[model samples]
Target: MSAPDARPVRGKRPKSGDPVVDRALALLAAFTEEHRALGLVELSRRAGIPRSTASRLAARLQAWGALERDEHGRYVIGLRLFEVASLAPRSHGLREAALPYLEDLHEITRQHVLLAVLDQGAALLVERLSTLGAVQVAYRVGGRLPLHDTGVGLVLLAFADAAVRAQALSELDSPAAATLRRRLADVRRTGVAVFARRRPAAVSSVAVAVRDGAGRVVAAVSVVVPVDAARPQAYEQVVRATALAVSRALGARPARAE
Candidate 1:
């Protein structure tokens, strides 16, 4: 028998002194929207770990309630992970303050309502609401959107720090760079962003900034509608109203009318 404090020495541990914590995290990261449930073989392949190592690590994760097995014996992400992730102050606090306004907008438009924040040089979608027959969009909660695309991404980029703006601009070609600069200038002047895309489906997004108590643009609220359903401009005013409402809920003062 081992001492109470002694770590388990069972199984053939990796001989290279690999970081077990990172390997464990990799196992968790292997699960995605398209691959929510995975057998041990697929999980090992996706995580790039040896089958035996994966089995050992998976057992530990299961014991900690970070993973669960479905009736089919495939591993699934556990509720304990969500319970922990829900405590992240940024996403949790912002979602709490924005959900009611988001729901109101959703009910009014019956379209996709998005709330996203700047994270890791991209717009991280924190919340989304959609109806049964709403237009399908590629974005999902917890997904990162490009800063140079999407209405919320553009709004966040427009209000981002100068250094971040430069980094994003530097990645574009000369002509595209010039066009984006002009667009960013317009977004800053109007405090709103309108972006349209044709691929997957023709849709337009109208987005406006959400501010925090300190008057900083902390998030963006947007409504996505099919091009044929309504002109993107038609929803601009309502989207702006929703954004302002969410901002007020976050302790931001209302902007004085021009």
Candidate 2:
């Protein structure tokens, strides 16, 4: 028989002391591209804790400057969190290596270009160059997209160790999701990612895996071109070449391109 005031629980149990801290983080996890802001009830429901508990946790987060209250009284991540998140080594390190080349590709193609890294099983855009006429991609710098949908996502998934790859696939529900295993296999075999326009062939993206010093894919470099002018083979060639140059900048020497 549970008491009426018993503590609410969700996710796995806290592995350490500071249950409040874990609950606070769980609340933070509820904010995603799909829902950047959440009311108290929604937050509590998503966090899987009691509303009273979530209220206390939210106050702590707000005080710590990790979250802010919106005009409508919903809570959203604050600039302080972005500042803290930026210090993550994977984001800053990969951006440092890819920024220059991303700029070059953007200038040469006069289109949208991006560099992304795999983080926590999602493709996190680290750098982007959006031209005046580039198609509207559903991603932005620091944004996370499914590893089973986007071009960089596939390449990142391809290079990931087996367990991570399996986990990502298991989360997708669309029929196309099943196709990713084969797509990733092809990417692993060819070291490049080629895709048609993300929106009704509005624009197509060509991507190549950028390797790290250990010959492992660390990031992806890509160019987005208008569908009308898309030449998949030509784009593939240039992107692969640029990716190799960037890889060299990072001291990765793949046998095929070295």
Candidate 3:
């Protein structure tokens, strides 16, 4: 719910910045959605603090086990943070109900399948199943992805609250953002996202929304196949069927046929 890093100060010199609080959080912020590991110098550079300041703060963090010094002398976020992050309530609940369907879909498709939820203005891939035949997708479980870039990401942003939706759009480029707005409207109307290659070497991704018992789109399910084998109609049918099956499993009844 809160931004990863905030300007909250504990003890401080008033106006400009607090050396203590900023450096502490800066050590933590040194780990990003991408690089979860960093050397002291790299961490210092990423956090915009001096190496000596980073070393001092990092020592305390290591003492508390919030970070650990690795074999190469680089530091990584510790297991304690991961242990705490794993206790997030929404993540615990979503997987319990949606997992069986996710497994079934993965088994059926034999491709890269994903289940993701909207979190903090980005879509987080909470679960993923990759088959041998599947194309190599950039997505990883627990990774944060841009909402306008991936199939599941689009659906989650499409039905998100207005402020979150606005934040998602702001993260996009102007032309791509405009394209996404129109694409989202279509996803809402059609209830599916068929994301195929717009250029060479892109994977074909097809996705659909999954509703909970309350009929809200709590998560999105998607499949990625090789673009060379892309058949929009075929992928669309399989994705819709799997989504409907999953929805019913979650106790969501389909709207009557139009």
RMSD of each: 5.3, 4.7, 5.8
User: In candidate 2, residue 221 scores what lDDT?
Assistant: 78
Tens digit per residue, CA lDDT, model 2, 1-258: 121333546755565758877788999998888889999888888888778778888998999889999999999999898788778767776777777877887778787887888888888888888976666776788788667767788888899989999898788776756688788889988887777754645767788888888988888878877777857657887788788888888898768633
Question: lDDT per residue, candidate 3, 68-136, as tens digits?
Answer: 978888899888776776777557466667778778777877778888888887889888889865767
**lDDT winner:** 1
Q: Candidate order by lDDT, highest to lowest? A: 1, 2, 3
Candidate closer to the true structure by TM-score (higher is better), 2 or 3 = 2
lDDT of 1 by residue, 1-258 (tens): 111322437775646657788889999999988999999988988997767778899999999889999999999999888888898868978999899989999999999999999998999999999887988899999898898889999999999999999999999999999999999999999988999999788889999999999999999999999989888999988999999999899999976861
Query: Rank order by TM-score, top first?
Result: 1, 2, 3
Q: State every prediction's TM-score relative to the real structure.
A: 0.88, 0.80, 0.77
Task: Single out the weakest 10-residue window by summed lDDT for candidate 1.
Answer: 1-10
Q: Model 2, stretches more than 4 Å misplaced?
A: 1-18, 71-73, 165-185, 197-201, 254-258
Any runs in candidate 1 off by more than 4 Å, and if so which? 1-18
